[model samples]
Each structure stands twice: as structure tokens, then as C-alpha cells.
Target: MTDSDRERWDARFTGLGPGEPGPPGALVGREHLVPASGRALDLACGRGTVAVWLARRGLEVDAVDVSPVGLAAGRAQAPEVHWIRADLDDGLPVTGPYDVIVCQRFRDPALHPALIGALAPGGLLVISVLSQAGDAGGPFRAPPGELLAAFGGLAVLHHAEGHGEESLVARG
Candidate 1:
């Protein structure tokens, strides 16, 4: 993202309070899919909700976001998580063979390859984004079948595109 775009995100997050602790959206009902021990990366991890949950689940976690304010809140709440301030638009800074990779509420097609490459063999990938499929959202949302086509190589555990959201849980 451009400097202005990142600043916008920072402003947005700054006005909001820290998020409640929680597991990744895709792992809500399927927590068993998460490995008991492994490394995790949370991209665009606003306020570190998912990152903190990963750490609580016994996984070392790296959480990245462009908003320093957001990272600060996360660090205050979950000091165990490694919070990295970075502009994901530049590219993922994490060099990972992470056991789990999560990208939530952030969409950038150009980063897909990097996300896939960061996952370890037999690793899990959890992604969720706004979608146009089930709801009449704007152009930023994904169209039908976008997630499946983008991550077809992985063994899908769950997939849903509707309600203005698209989510996928897969294993690479």
C-alpha cells in the first residue's frame, strides 16, 4: 500500500480498541485442525487477536501489520506474540516455513504467491476476505470461486463464500 493508504489504516485502527482474543476465523469450529505445536504467521494482524490466540494454543506466532498503533495494542495484550510493523503491500517480510499461515480481512492478489510459499509442507493455510459472491459487495470483494481457484493445490478442509465473506481452510 502507499504511504497514504497505510496511514489510513493506522488511523482506522487507532480509533478502535483492541480486539477480543480469539482463534482464527477459519478455526472457529475446527480448532482440531491447528497443530498443538508449530509456528504461525498472521498477516495484516490487526490488534493481534488471532496471533495471540495462536500463541495461547502453544504455537509461536509472528503478527504483521502496517499500523503501529494496532501493533502496540496487541503487544500490550499479548506480549508473547512477535509483532512486526510492516507494509504488506511491499511484500511479506516473514521468511517462514510456518506450520500455519493466516491472512484475514486483507486482500491483495499480488501477495498470494508469497503466502503459499511461506507455508511449510503439510502446513495449514487459513484465509478469509470480503467477497461479492454471497453478498452484493463492491469491486474489492472476491467473486465466486476465487478462493478455490487461487488455492486449488492445497487439500481443502473447509470453504465458504457468502454473506459478504469468503473463508477457506486448507492444508498444503
Candidate 2:
């Protein structure tokens, strides 16, 4: 991401305030799949909602984002989480064999393979993205079946596409 991209995100997050930590969108009804004790990585973690949630569940959490302002808010909410400041465009900064990985509201096809490779045995992956499946198509939205096409090799736990969103939960 460029400096302007970071600044744009920082500005947006600054207005949103410190967001409440919550379960990942894809894990809403499948929360039991989350490992009780293991390491987790939250990509494009924004205000660290999922990262903080994982930490509270006894996992060591790493949350990455480009916005310093966003990280600060999350840091205040859960100081235990390792809040990383980096652009995802440069690829993942932290090597991983994480027991759980989450990417919510962010879609980057280039990162999908890396995400799969980073999972530990039987690790869980929870991801959600805006989609064109049940809405007007757009450049920023994933095409139909995008999640399954990208992650079908995994042991799919759940998958849904509708209401302009797509989500997948799988075990590696």
C-alpha cells in the first residue's frame, strides 16, 4: 500500500473510534471451532476486534494493519495482542503456523495461498469479504464462488454467499 492508502485508512479508523472486539464474521455461529489455546493471526485486523477476541480466548494473537491509529485503539483494548503495523501489499510480515487465522472484510487474492500455507495442522481459517454474488458487481467485490474457488481444497466447515457478502470457514 502507498503512504496515501495508509493515511486514508488512518483517517477512516480515527473517525470510527475504538471498535468493540468481537468474533470473526465467519465464526459468528461457529465460535466453538476456535482453538482455546494456540496462536492466531488476524490479517487486515483494522481495530483488532478479532485479534482481541482471540487473546481473550487464551490464544496468542497477532493483528496486522497499515493504520497506526487503528492499532492504537486496539492496543488500548487488549494490550496482550501483538499489534503489527505493515502493509499487506508487501505480504505477511510475520511467518506463521497459526492454529487460527482470520481475514475479515478484506479481499486480496494474492494472499490466499500464503494464508493456506501458514496454517498449522487442523488449523481453522475464518474469512469474510464483500462480494458481487448477491449484489451488483463491482471492482472491489469478489466474483461469485470466489471463496470456494480459492479455498475448496480445505475441509470446509461452512460457506455462504449472499447479501453482498461471502464467508468461509475451513480446517486445514
Candidate 3:
């Protein structure tokens, strides 16, 4: 990301106040897929909602984001989750065979492979992002079949792109 991107995100997060914990957007109705106890990674974990939720579910979580302000907000909610401030433009800052990995509202096709590789056998991967398939086209949105094509090797449990959102849940 550019310097402007970091500033933009920092300002955006700085403006936000505290928020309650919430489920990962892609795993909302499919919480059963989440491992009962294991390590998790929440990439681009703005404000740490999903990270905290995963921690509450008994997973050791590492939440990564570029914005320190956002990480601080997340820390307030879930002190147990390890919050790491890093620019994902450099790729995932950590590597692991995690039992669960979540990336929400962030689209970086370059990291798709790394995400899959980070998953342990039988691990769950949940992702949600803006899409252009069923919405107006934009620079940040994924095209139709983007997720499917990138994660084709996984055992896809659910995949959909419409209503301006693309989401996928798969097992690795």
C-alpha cells in the first residue's frame, strides 16, 4: 500500500469509536465450521471483531491490520488476541498451519495462495469482500469467479458473488 493508503486507513479508524464483537462476515451463519480450539488468523482485521469472536470461541487469534488505531480498539475488546500492526501490501506478516483464517472486506488477490497455505489440514477459511459481479464495477471489487478460481483446490462449502459482496467458506 502507498503512504496515502496508510494515512487514509489510519484516519478512518481513528474516527471510529469502540464497537462490540461480531462474527466474521463470511462465517456468520456457519459458525459450526470454526474449529472449537486451535490457532486462527484474521487478516486485515479492522477493529478486531472477528479476532475477538474467535478468541471467545477458544482459539488463539492473531489479528493483523495496518491501522494501529484499529488495533487499539480491538485490543480493548479482546486483550487475549494478539494484535499485530502490519501492512498487508507486504503480504501476510505471519505464517502458520492455522485451524481457521478469515479475511473480510479486504481484497488482495496476491495473498490468496498464502491464505490457503496457511491453513492446516481440515482448517476452515472464511472470506468476504466487495465484488463487482452483482454490483457496479470498482477498482477494489472482485470480479465474478475470482474467489472460486483462486481457491478451487479447497473443499468449498459455500461460495457466492452477488448483492455487491463475494463470500466463500472452504475447508483446506
Candidate 4:
């Protein structure tokens, strides 16, 4: 992403402020599936809410984002989390064999393979993204069946698409 893109995200987070800790969007009702203790990675982890939640659940957590302001807000909430600031446009910076990986509201088909490769055996992948399915299509929205097309090989535990969002929870 460009420096202006980073600045825009920083400004947006500055306006939104720190977020409350919560389960990853796709894991909201199925929180039981998350391992009680394991390594976790939150990609494009804006404000680090889900990352902090994972840490609180007794998991080692790494939260990555492009905005320093957002990372700072999350770091304040949980100093234990390893907060990484890097433009995802540079590509996935952290290698992994993570037990749980989450990417919410961030769509990059280019990283799908890297994400799947990062998971440890029996690891869970939680992802949510804006989608055109059941809504007026837009440039940023994924086409219908996008997540399934990209991740169908995994053992999908949950999948939902509608109302401008697509979410999936699958085991690697």
C-alpha cells in the first residue's frame, strides 16, 4: 500500500479509537472452536480487538496492521501481543505454523495460499470480507463464492454469504 493509504488508515483508526476485545467476526457464535491455548495470528488486525481476545484466551498472539496508530491502541490494551506494523502490499511478513489465523474485512486473493500454508495441522482459519453477494456489487467486494473458491480444499466448518459480507471458518 502507498504511504497515503497508510495515512488514510491511520486517520480512520484515529477517528474510531481503540476497539473492545471480541472474538473474530466469523467465530462469534462458534467461539468454542478456538483452541484454549495456542499460537494465533491476526492479519490486517485493525485495532487488535480479536488479537487481544486470542491473547486473553491464553494463546500467544501476533497482530499485524499497516497503521501505527491502530497498533498503538491495541498494544496499550495488551502489551503481551507482538504488534507488527507493515504494509500487507509488501506481502505477508511473518512466516507461521499458527494454530489460529484470522483476517477480517481484509481481502487479498494473492495471500490466500500463504495463509493456508501458515496454518499448523488442525489449525483454524477465520476470515470475513465484504462481498457483492446479496448486495449491489462494488469494486472492493468479492464476487459470490469467492471464499469457497479460494479455500474449498480445507475442512470448512462454517460458511456464510449475504448482506454484503462473506465469512468462513475452516480447519487446515
Best by the TM-score measure: 4
Clashing pairs in 1: none
Off by over 4 Å in 2: none
Worst lDDT 10-window in candidate 2: 12-21
- Poorest 10 consecutive residues by lDDT, candidate 3: 17-26
Cα lDDT tens digits for candidate 4, 1-172: 8889899988899967679999977888899999999899999998999999999999999999999999998999999999999888778989899999999989999999999999999999999999999999898899999999999999999999999999999999
- Give lDDT tens digits, candidate 3, residues 112-152: 98998899999998998899887988999988888999997
Ranking by lDDT: 4, 2, 3, 1
Q: How close to the true structure is residue 92 of candidate 3, measured as C-alpha lDDT?
A: 88
Please provide TM-scores, in order, for all candidate models, with all chains considered together.
0.94, 0.96, 0.96, 0.97
Sorted on TM-score, highest at the top, how do the candidates line up?
A: 4, 2, 3, 1
Q: Write the residue-wise lDDT of candidate 2 on 1-172 in tens digits.
A: 8899899999988978778878987888789999899999999999888888899999999999999999998999999899999899888788889999999988899999999999998999999999998899887899989999999999999999998999999999
Distance from true position, residue 62, model 1, in Å?
Answer: 0.7
Candidate 1 off by > 4 Å = none
The local distance difference test score of model 3 is 0.89
* Number of residue pairs clashing in candidate 3, backbone atoms closer than 3 angstroms, sequence gap of 3 or more or interchain: 0
Give the alpha-carbon lDDT of every model: 0.89, 0.92, 0.89, 0.93
Better of 2 and 4 by TM-score: 4
The alpha-carbon RMSD values of the candidates against the true structure, listed in the order shown, are: 1.3, 1.0, 1.1, 0.9
How far out, in Å, is residue 29 in model 4?
1.3
